[model samples]
Target: MTMASIAAPARTAAGELATFCGSLRWAELDEAVRQRTRELLLDLLGVTLGGSRVESSSAPRELAQGAGDGQATLIGTRQTSSADWAALANGTAAHALELDDVTTESSLHPGVAIIPAALGLAEELDASPAAMLEAIVAGYEVTMRVGNALNPASAYARGFHPTGVAGAFGAAMAAGRLLDLDDERLTHALGIAGTLASGSLEYLSNGAWTKRLNAGWAAHAGIVAARLAGAGFTGPSTVFEGRLGALHAYTDEPYVERLVEDLGRPLQVMRVSIKPYACCRYNHGLIDCMLSLRGSFGLDDVERIRLGVLSGGALLVADPIEQKRAPANVVDAQFSAPYASAVALVYGSGSLESYSTEKLADPRVRRLMSVTDCYRDASLDAVYPRQWPAAAEVVLRDGRRLSTRVEYALGEPENPVPLDALMSKFISLAGRDDAEALADRILHVDADPSVRALGTALRSGGGST
Candidate 1:
């Protein structure tokens, strides 16, 4: 399908995305894509419910509650807030746990930004389940496309978080779809959202809560942009590839063809990885390596641990080795390779609980981190952004060395976690067996008249803090 059939003064990038978003239909989506949407939504709802109770979500949740107009339900809570507020609150919560679905190639977590906006607006406008799913697909496509074009590793090195930057477009696509905006209005929404996009990688160094709020902020801004556009507001149609636009602003070189390549023929959402561990996607392979070797050696038998990770990833999670060894807080610990490897080696697992303050205070974990070393493997740099590969070696007290390497993390598309496994994760995170029943309903959501049933089910079962 051509990006734009509309007569244009110029066939701009924004016009292409607008055309795609405006014309996308559920009927054109493959069965696999539809089923994947259900799986992604189920996981997203579960993680949002789990994240809602985290300490980081407190201020936003309180703010949303204070600003409430009952337009939408805040995933875990029975309380309601305006669509934008709800999106902000829930989107923040969704990302707080670091369990959201992600496309590693784009370095964007699709569900956190898109799902909150789509679900919030779906509840507010009483949009159908089919529409919600279509919105979700469009959101993923646009977000990943923009992220892909940016060359995420280079963007990351430039101190930008791709998710926070690209997520605005994703949320806008979803919101525009739900609003049923035409090509022109959807183009305006993209332009507005592009200007609104912003996020900093500084949070990685400080363990600040701002990183958790980036996707949520983008989601909030996108909803507002879409609403404004629907009200006939005008925005720059050349907002993408223009000299002063998002593409040039975010990356040194933008591969703009990636923005519309293959369009909807092969859905981008299918490429996303559902995180198994609650940490940065860059650290997943390292953690997986540690998890794999946990039973082979004892933490007490270890004298030192060494990690070889991609140079780009080292910039995010493993550099400044001392800081990684002694993280200041849970968020810091979550992104620390030494800390993560230590947690896995000492405890035989890494979960949401593993990054808690109490766990951070564990003497064994601390001692392990102190002995752990993380360094860049220049040899593995070529495989990065496509596959997050890691190599690990443990030096034991008895003069024995055990080593392993993992090319794919447990939840990567190449090594996917099964749907049943995802459902089990959903049940655990949602904190109720009823999540299974909800998953059943979500699988057939296309047949539902409205998305309100999913919202209703979401509010109940699992997580109330």
Candidate 2:
């Protein structure tokens, strides 16, 4: 077949998305969608604070600190930097703990990439809080839509990190909106992002910190791409559906129509899940199952643990079974189903505290991990990318098998975390006495004239009530 015969309609997908991003207004958002956006922002901010001091964030934070001063606040710090640099530091920190908001169908952490880029540019431009929220909504919509189109399973099969690859486009849309780029320029921004979008699953090989860098780099590249677009730079308009476009290049299976399907009827922000656990989203359901079963049996009575994982996510959290059972660090533990199960069964919870160095060396946890076996279950994969169901079966020393299955993890929209619980989580992660007040400010940011005060309040070692 000729190129023309197989080529997608020129610019259709990118054009539609650019038009949506360029024209999306705060006034168009209903209170529910707006509230969801605010909640996601609060969650992102809390996670950023919680992860700012992590080893993975150290290099990026230092680079941002030394990149020269600008108007943007480096989140979780009493410092300022250029918009892109600030985005780099804040995005990396937001994802460091794996607690950022994630999507069901998209299978990517939208807020980590979108919120940091939007916040930094919004601060630099002195934009209204409403504008910032709108930019974030636009970013989430684009990111999730692109992720859905990429067929996350196929992307993972190719050893690509969907969060980093799809996140760049989302960040560009948010940044470009903040820069007041029109539809054409926003389209160019997406095209520019296409070249910059990248993330390798190779981080899984050795528990590398590069996985955390994916979010930061996506945010940085997005700001740079938008800035380049705003400076009259030109890029291909058919960046999504073209033969060599993102959808084709990133995955073997591309649901291209998903990009424009039901464009903003309900808004993608409403579909996001806040993570209660500090690990891969794939392990959350299994942890929930383990937590539910822990009280029913004594730890010493367990002979073996069998986990049901979705085929799509198996590569992420279950495969290389031996490696999953022996996590070397926090990053490894975060992606290991066996480790997640072991910790939840041993500690009866999967909080950030459960993934520490002490837990990594805990003999009880290691023993449980040794007995854990993760297998792909067709039942779990049947509704995956929509519902991340999981199951766990424990064999007792007396030959009794105790089994439990979870339809939705605690933080999923279907099994949503209560507002008070979310607040408690924010307080715990932010580690601040005034976290409640800061959360309130974040929730009602749309009423504020500018993001300056809100940005200041998000900084560490300062901005206390």
Report the C-alpha lDDT of model 1 over 28-109, residue by residue, as the tens digit.
8778888888889888988998898888898998898888586688878877788899999999999999889888778789
Error of 1 at 233 (Å): 1.4
Model 2 Cα lDDT, one tens digit per residue, 355-457 = 8999999999999999999888888888988899999999999999999999999899999988887888888888777888888888888778898768777
TM-score of each: 0.94, 0.96
Provide the lDDT at 14 for model 2: 81
List the pairs of residues colliding in candidate 1: 430-462
Best by lDDT: 2
Residue 41 displacement (Å), model 1? 0.3
**Runs off by more than 4 Å, candidate 1:** 1-10, 461-465
